[model samples]
Target: MINEVILDDFSLKVTSFEQGVSTSSSGTEAKTIRFDFEVRGGTEYHDVTVHLYKNTFDVKVPELDLSFRGTINNYSTSRTDFTNENSSSLFRLELIEIG
Candidate 1:
């Protein structure tokens, strides 16, 4: 289903996001999102943020998470590319692990 998502014009609207966690102590979990979009000229990789919510289902999280936005540029398909907008010195981005 994720492979079906497309990026439009190197720009994508983040629909939904979540931090992947594991119950086992030996495993390491991080934040991720259900990034979806389709763009002409391919989507540009950029530094985006995953806002951590204090209260579940809180709308105010967006504003609070603005500061914690991380730079993670993952392209599910070849249609996406890196651009100036998303090229930040803070974080580096790479391709998603697809199997």
Candidate 2:
């Protein structure tokens, strides 16, 4: 199974992953990557979310031997705040290649 993706400067362990192609209205196609990852600490959750807010990143999925300049097409988290100790959050992210 594919378990990791390097997004910008952070290496994340993915719980699940998917890869596909997306077609635009003009019949152009682009690569798409989606994954689910969990952050087990409040500080970590804060860090990951900060990275997610950036406009674009260099993404690499080593198991698939794929790399691209991508942006977040979709993103979601199980919770809003992770201030408490021992907190954990499940995050789903979908990225589409733009370069």
Candidate 2 lDDT tens digits, 13-69: 999999999999988999999999998667787788787778589999999889999
Residue-level lDDT tens digits of model 1 in 2-29: 2221121122333333334223355544
CA lDDT of every candidate: 0.29, 0.88
Candidate 2's C-alpha runs over 4 A off are: none
Best by lDDT: 2
Candidate 2 global TM-score: 0.93
Give TM-scores for every candidate, taking all chains together and pairing residue i with residue i.
0.28, 0.93
